[model samples]
Target: MSNSTHISTLIKERTGLDVGTQFRADLETILHDLAKGDLEQYLADLRATNENAPPWQTLMRALTISETYFFRDSAPFQLLRQPILPNIILERRHHKRLELNVWSAGCSTGEEAYSLAILLYELLPDLDSWTIRLKASDINNHAVQIARQGIYREWAFRHTNNGFQTRYFDPAPGGWQIKPHIQRMVSFSQNNLLNEVPRPQFDLVFCRNVLLYIANDFTKAIETLIFDSLIPGGWLIMGQSEAIRWQRERWTTHVFADATLYQKPLPHQIMTPPSRYPIASIPAMPDYELALDALYNERSSEAEQILKGILAEKPGHAPTHILLAYILGSRHALSSAHRHLDDALNSDGMLADAHYLRATLFLEEGKDVESREALRAALYCQRDHPLAALMLGNLYASIGDMAKASRTWESARQAVIGLPPETRVSVLSDMTAAGFDALVKGQLGIANK
Candidate 1:
């Protein structure tokens, strides 16, 4: 029962978004950084402005970390390719209309929405005959604009293995531009998830890796909205880390491999957890563990060999890909590392460790912006991420934003304090809550109370 502050209420009123305790540091950082410590004056200016959108949107933009690559998480895509798409297609076949409506809520730059379209094209033999609509929305207008453009850098294709780049993208002056048909498939709009999602009753909805940043009440409200947006039997997939505690009576939890899914069950459908998938698709037990051991001990080559061996057996084993990325990163094989990171996330976007590793890699390479995004993604995936908040706070310090940095450090301290003794986060950084507090107090001139 956390009470919302005035600033939090303002944000909630404007966008139906909550700046919860978890995001307090983030909000404070943005406000303090923008205002240069005179937050009250900034607030007054914001209040006086007729164009309320700018101030609010600026804060929102800073708060959002758009750290997405195309097909960064592949489990849901697998479900789509295997059964979801086929089932949806079959369900609508009786009407003689191959109609599909899909929504990618919080779609950063249209990669996910386009990925769905590509899957649809690949699966259906007669795609042209079908009435297809892939609608994508983001609260960030800049991201929405970028999504509409359909042009992206090489980095965006890191997780992409389907040769979609070869078939669907043309080399542009700056980067790769998606072709007309793929572009035509997805429609991007700037919309906040909390308030309005115009198109309802989607066959499949993707709101992956997006909800955990919001407050609990808003998250439930958003979930309710998603439930309402679905066709009776439509499936809703979230990020790997996000496990919905929705009332079992309304939805059936479907476990597929390491992925858990919720399907909007139709009338008279049982509300029990779906049985374990009978397919022998899970990675062989010892190899992944062995690979992890090799990775932690600095056996880069050995780890790569082990991971590659496992990958040959189970190409979709995302953890292997992530480990391989870490190994390659140590070797300064940055491009290769990006591919592995993308593939790992593509395989399972819920891997907070992978995002943490990506942040570490980015920091090593002196890519602070990329590291920030990676850290944010890691926190979003797993709030109790190891050293993520600390590193991000250090990153702000490096950028000379002491106010933001100090606030972030405080947040990290609070997070650590709340952790159970047994489940405490461990990182090689060897930094503790006491150490962080001392550093922040000394550097940022905070008074000891």
Candidate 2:
């Protein structure tokens, strides 16, 4: 068998992962770049080496893309505001000290971490009187560094609004910086969620969007770890897409008007069977859907008015800020757009669309320098982000830097190749029409002389 085939078979046998031809090609590309040895030789060497390696930390890091942002999945935050916080407060009201502890596992770059801090500040009027502990941890060192800085570009907040900008951040040298009080509310550290030693238990744990990357076994294990890490009767929050059936058996499920929350079962409370029906069967808010449609159709003024009306009715609606930022950007209201973006990012930093949109806006405004930075930020937040690379390459081309443009296009090409076949065709066609062919053939290695 060929070396690539051998490697693919081994990977499938061991990991039970059936990657597509595109991903297999990408894996070969990665191996070629490494050039330590051929696949079989490398696998043989790995077997001959230590009986135990550091639990494949490097592989885990590569496989797991910890992309997050402020106030991701508004439903969880809604539940936090409506039911979770109120329940905790009521339960602990008689205690001599009222305290709340929150942990954001796999926090990425502190967007979710800071979002929680902001939520606490906004939710609790007498926050000073309550003992609040918010801890965020991630396994990625680079992400940890960025989290500690607490500085982000205008692009990062593309889904925020003017009011949120005025309230939360101070304009810094290059971008916006989180306020000192906001900064102090959360502490960050490097932590592997797979750590053997038990960490302090939390009252609320937000481990969103991280489980999707791991194998099913690993997912269950991590969910169990989260369960163990929470205090009895504590809330365990997950991303909108993630759920735990076994954990649900051990916990009581609470359904808010818009979202679902899980709580550890109290002494007298018996866990109820989850409803057989899907959540999607529930009707969506017509006004919100109409607003989104208007925004998507590029009617910025109309969308802005709709979103503002939605906000007036539901002030805590986080998604409105993001939509407002998009509208503001479309209107060339960069400053106002940034305000809304910041608010949206502050709430949930993982909105990749917002980051992508903001970068495009920066490019349009002739801020090439800032646009480059924004493009990089967008890619860091979303590795497979095509718009970021496309814009970045176009920027380089406009500046007559063919080499950089070629490299950016090559990266874009590589990214798109891993996508669905239809998506690949569309992206490649777009790139080609944008004069990517000359650059790719000229500087990138893909084309022959």
Candidate 3:
């Protein structure tokens, strides 16, 4: 076998990590750095060392980015802080058993696991009575060591508030140290999800952002492992982009405002967790709201699914079509996205977001004429649409129309300035008013130059 193919196969066999084209460059760099440009020697060394050895650990560090922070997404944590954990607490209380088990799989640097411990502390007032097992594991040994240390720099606390920092962390040399009590709640270990056994004990399994990196061949195996690890009625929270695609009907899908979770249903037992936007409240409003919530949380797949279902029932649903188009556009299915946008505009030509998204798709494909028309339509529909205005201004500037670009950008700035900085431009968008303002201001400065 060629050295490249052999190395990739060896990595798959040893680590179950995908050495796909995206990672080929990184693999070559690792070989050069570790083996002094000798591919055969690196292969020999890799084969000789077991997973727990220093060589394997160093390889893992290079392969995995370990880019994470405390309460990284905030949505799953919100779901846990509410109905999930509270419901578990009630059921356990009824059985006169105060015990909780949680697994944070692929917990890079321990931020997520520590976040869970802090959430539990806040939720359970009588915490001393409960027996908690928060097991956090990652394949990277270096990360595990850092997790055990429980110290993190300020960068890790970007999403965290000052009050939380003061309450749970003490200022230490070079960084902040997690309080002893919170540290005691968690146990860290080096673990590969591929090697995970079915324990059937955890009340919650958080395997977020881990499946995206696993080899496609091993993804199902890891998924099965995660499913088996959770007790009946236990919840599994994965990343926004990932979901249980295989045997999906076996698990109950819980659509929440901030997150979508899969629950292993109990045998012959129906589970209904309370929701702020309950599905039973109104006929179609709940599903639409759920879709909006999914979009807000960056759960594009979930939003797309719900929006499609809505479209199946009500084909003329302009809003649903617009949302589905946005999701499709994100996936680069431009033609499909354009069709959806056309359907939305047909239903309601006044839909500014639909026009804006269509403009974006057109711009992506380099159809400047069509894109400019769409942008104008969007601005006409909603005069204060910052995104449409910004894009239109940038389009003008690209053609060296500095005067028009500057005037359009000034309008864009005014449109964005009225909204709260933290307010999202739309439920279907991740950009906030503050971000839009920054973009316009940056463009204006460049235009003047």
Query: Which has the greatest lDDT?
Result: 3
lDDT, candidate 2, at 307: 78
Off by over 4 Å in 1: 1-5, 12-26, 36-38, 41-52, 197-200, 270-449
| Cα deviation of 137, candidate 1, in Å | 0.7
lDDT of 2 by residue, 175-261 (tens): 779999999999998766665254546899988777655456556667788877788777878777777746558876755434566
Runs off by more than 4 Å, candidate 2: 1-24, 31-62, 245-247, 271-449
- Candidate with better TM-score, 1 vs 3: 3
For residues 367-449, could you state the per-residue lDDT of candidate 1 as single tens digits? 88999999998766545443676777778888777777777766665555533444324422334545644554564454222
Candidate 3 TM-score over all chains jointly:
0.60
Ranking by TM-score: 3, 1, 2
TM-score of each candidate structure, all chains considered together: 0.57, 0.53, 0.60
Worst 10 residues of 3 by lDDT: 275-284
lDDT of 3 by residue, 221-310 (tens): 888898889899888999877887676777888775446788887875444433221101011245776887887777879988988887
Tell me, what's the RMSD of every candidate? Answer: 18.8, 20.1, 18.8
Worst 10 residues of 1 by lDDT: 275-284
Clashes of each: 4, 23, 0
